[model samples]
Target: MGSLVVFSPLFFFVLAIQMSSLMVSLSQEGFCSAPPILNAADSTAQPLYWKVTNPTLSPSHLQDLPGFTRSVYKRDHALITPESHVFSPLPDWTNTLGAFLITPAMGSHFVMYLAKMQENSKSGLPLRDVERFVFVLHGTVFLTDVSGVTHSLNVDSFAYIPPNSTHHIKCDASSTLVVFERRYSYLESHYTDLIIGSTDKQPLLETPGEVFELRKLLPTSLPYDFNIHIMDFKPGEFLNVKEVHYNQHGLLLLEGQGIYRLGDSWYPVQAGDSIWMAPFVPQWYAALGTSRSRYLLYKDVNRNPL
Candidate 1:
């Protein structure tokens, strides 16, 4: 097994529109329901039952949260599954917190999450995995890698880990971080031995590089033909034409905004968002706003056939 860590900001944009009458229409038919309570024990505590707990913090921006006089309490992002696991979706602008399990899938198996870290808690559990990537969303942390190397990562700082590499984290005296994890597949059991100077061992390309223009670069074939790449699109730029290829791909927007075309329909996309497209799904996208949009794009080209 092997791992690669490319630390960068994330971006995805999705427009969530709720019509005023939609709430009444749903209640009439009982379409919406309340979520259940969750109880979890810390690494070393008797199993305890817990319900959604709201914090007493106040909204930072008055203009952003109108009508609400104070910050409201919200429940935990995810519900506990019957199997005793936590699976939650990434949080959005309204709530700067959430987490979910990324394991139990064929392509990637492991738990991954995104949320605002607690300022008072400086320690967290470290796990053994093929690889890991942690990006700082806000605040700083003391990151220790497998080799006992330590580094300070503040907002916008990123880190990558190789397969089987052991690493731990220590948040700054008081800081918050958004963590992302990627695990290897033990089922496939086929990977080129980690080799240096080999064509397949090349590192992934990142945005704002000195040698290449990001938005203009397109992989001729899918699975990237190599490692994953993060690209950026300046306002007004776009991948206007449909791109059809054999590789499966995941695109997560890190910044800016745009409309993505997927089979006769156009979907709006922006930062803190993601989309999964396979070979059969022909898709393309274009930037839609004034801000430069960046995104994390990952594709595994040399995996065994399903």
Candidate 2:
């Protein structure tokens, strides 16, 4: 008993270390927990959309400005739809003109948004429903949602609206926001036309968290596992340990910093980083700074094709 007691703490310490490493490994391997069933502990399992914080400029928030510098992936661009294009076809970030990274288009699903904005414009030109997101390296803008949620956005600020949700904006300020064009499955079309003037109450759906510009890291047409999600990890927050049966992960780092371990390589990633890993890549990481490490995380919840 004496020998056992002395070794017990060490055993637990080793176990804890192993457990943390294993947790990250599993996440990297695309081993994510299944979405809970209806009525279970987390029955809803709906996507939680985070609202953009800090609309007004405060002295304390001044230092948060990311350098005007930007990064772009140097890869061939692929056209996904009528409005969206994929690839790192833009100029390098080191250029004085700044970088231009295009996101997959927001296709015709949300045409009402563009139409409303056009109606308000002097030319009254109709806009397409497709939405696209782009990261802004500098400046600010005035943003107003359909419900009159008015606010001033600054550099690095993010804006997100639910599919079919109406919003209007004016970038006549010093703020530059990366616009992420998100095109949802449009599972329901009833709300598509409820733009700037709808008497009906907003029918809410699971919305993705709000952050700077972002687009679907994975192709929409690709019949991936039915249940996939993307989220930003705040410093130190991690996905708990769980077993996963699926493989194939698509990850993109949007902002901040972190080192992601995929397979044998520890890829140090920051804004504009992306990785496509095969099944069982044994992934995980820790945030490298006080700001949250934001990324577009995609995993096949079901179905595995070689």
Q: What lDDT would each prediction earn against the true structure? A: 0.43, 0.36
Location of the lowest summed lDDT over 10 successive residues in candidate 1: 47-56
lDDT of 1: 0.43
The prediction achieving the highest lDDT against the true structure is 1
* lDDT against true structure, model 2: 0.36
- Estimate, for each residue in 1-306, the C-alpha lDDT of model 2 and write its tens digit: 355435454465345455545544553453433122123233224222111121111223224343312222222211111111122311321111211233223111111111011112211111244333322334545557667877654444444444445565555433323333334433332222211211112232333443222233323333322222345567665544322333544444544555554443344444444454444445665555445666544443323344
Per-candidate count of clashing residue pairs (backbone under 3 Å): 16, 25
Report the Cα lDDT for residue 204, model 2. Answer: 23
Kindly provide the TM-score of model 2 when superposed on the true structure, using C-alpha atoms: 0.36
- TM-score of candidate 1 against the unseen true structure: 0.51
How much RMSD separates candidate 1 from the native structure?
Answer: 16.1
Error of 2 at 208 (Å): 19
